[model samples]
Target: MTKESLKELILTLEKIQLVLIQEGEQEWVYGISSIKRRLTDINIDSPDFKKEFKSVQLSYLNMTNGAGSFSDVMIWRSNVEDRIKVNKDFNALTKKTWELFEL
Candidate 1:
């Protein structure tokens, strides 16, 4: 993928992280599957990154379908209240998730 799109995906992940922390509902962040789908293509040589990302993927799988319910987060996404701040900026999101992924 292009660098810009990758950044955008990472930023999306960051926003999801922000909402999960701020809103306390991890299942509401629907963009995770998008990021998970791209994991095989990231091409990062860091084993730690790979291991951590794989953990995320497995967690996502368990949360939605693997062992968890099929409750889709998109249904909740359409119901987000305006007062909740899920639309945080990319730089902050980037920085936050950077620390999270330990990249």
Candidate 2:
């Protein structure tokens, strides 16, 4: 993907994180699934992307288990934080990957 596309993806991810924080875990399910779909569309072969995407997917699955308790909220928050961190790392990696093509 182009750098602009990668930046857009990261921006979308940050928006999702904000939605999760404001609207709760139930609202986050759709956002996470959408992100997973976007990841699939990129079709990149990087192990880091796959690994980070898997982490986000698993955390999303755990958050959507219908528990609906305080602990579940905490877990969901933690998962969102993890996703944000992973997305930041992925953004950096994507920039570097694209830079290599310019050389």
Candidate 3:
């Protein structure tokens, strides 16, 4: 997503957080704070960043290397259901964790 889009998502989440708090669901306040921090930390103007960002999405494959792993395959390799596989495979674990939270 673009910076503007990320900002919009963060704003929406912030509103949700307020509602949650008023409803005594303070557990989600930290989630909203985390989202705001993460969205603001991104550099959406860089071409390479945008390219990589789009690459590993659940709908796009990773093509920077010769190996073409489909987006669904990529997601399967990194999502919560595959946490054990990720932990056992050191090669993509770091990237997976980063992608899981960032993308």
Candidate 4:
């Protein structure tokens, strides 16, 4: 990905983080949807980064579908853990992706 695209992705991830913190689990579907859409727009060439991104996406997808209510999707402990892991993984991947930018 180009530096500009990487920067955009970082911004998107930051937005996701904010949404997760302020809105909590119920609103995460929106953030995840935004992240997925943003991911599709970037050209990711690294296999490792692609894998990491996919991991985060899949985790969110599973959590989003685990419960009937999008607002209370994390009613279970496992679901809550999955969301935490997804956030952590996305944050790490975002940092790694940022390091690849030239300037």
Candidate 5:
């Protein structure tokens, strides 16, 4: 991706991060899809960083287990710790992705 696109990508992630933080699991579906689509649109010069982002999206995909239906919310809410962990993982990767520019 161009440096401008990469900057936009990270900013998008940061925005999604806020959505995840402020809303319920159901609210995350839109942001998740947006971020994943954003990733696909990126064309990075470094293959390894590209691969890393692809791997990162895998973690995000895991969070979509039931797509936040009422039943899923019932189950997911019971395991608040996992939800928190999921948020933290995404946040960590989002932060880590900025290091790609150091190259």
Candidate 6:
């Protein structure tokens, strides 16, 4: 991908990320659902999925309220989301936790 193409793709990914996050937060669905949907759309099951995911990794800094260092919020959050995708047992644990919470 040319630099311009990469920039465009990154912008698209950012939009996808935002939409996924909003859907997850608004509907109380797991964010991973949106992530999965978006990833799949980008041919995430293809042989190049892993490479593509890593190539366009996003990063940003954020500050909350008074007097704090600029924290790497977007990267941290993405890493967490990525972790939830990577850890094979996380979904099962999340389901069980939700079930217990609902009970």
Best by lDDT: 5
Cα-based lDDT for every prediction: 0.50, 0.50, 0.46, 0.53, 0.55, 0.38
Least accurate stretch of 10 residues (summed lDDT) in model 2?
Answer: 69-78
lDDT, candidate 4, 1-103, per-residue tens: 5556656656665655555556455456465566656565655666567665665555545544545633243322358777787657556644543343221
TM of each candidate vs. truth: 0.36, 0.29, 0.41, 0.33, 0.35, 0.26
Q: Count the backbone clashes (under 3 Å) in each candidate.
A: 0, 0, 0, 0, 2, 0
Q: Candidate 6 on 1-103: residue-level lDDT in tens? A: 3444434544543453454365343332333344334443655346876565543232111111234322212222357767555333433433332232221
lDDT of 5 by residue, 1-103 (tens): 5767666656656665555555654465565556656665656666676676666555554554465531133223357897777657565555454443231
Prediction 6 global C-alpha lDDT: 0.38
RMSD of each: 9.5, 13.6, 13.2, 12.4, 11.6, 14.8
Candidate 3 structure quality by residue, lDDT tens digits, 37-101: 55556577866766544443322222222443211222123467575564344325324433443
Write one digit per residue (lDDT tens) for candidate 2, span 40-95: 45535564665655555455445445677222333222588786775565455434
Question: What would the per-residue lDDT of candidate 1 be over residues 1-103, giving only the tens digit for each residue?
Answer: 3445446656657556565556556554454544545553565556566565666656545554533453322222354563233333323554454454444
Which model is ahead, 3 or 5, in terms of lDDT? 5
Give the C-alpha miss distance for residue 36 in model 1, angstroms: 8.5
Comparing 4 with 5 on TM-score, the higher-scoring candidate is 5
Worst 10-residue lDDT window, candidate 1: 70-79
Model 6 segments beyond 4 Å from truth?
25-103
Tell me the lDDT of model 6 at 56.
26
Please give the range of 10 consecutive residues that has the lowest summed lDDT in model 4: 69-78
Runs of candidate 2 with Cα error greater than 4 angstroms are 1-9, 19-45, 69-103
Q: Which stretches of candidate 3 lie over 4 Å from their true place?
A: 47-103
Which lDDT value does model 3 have at 57? Answer: 38
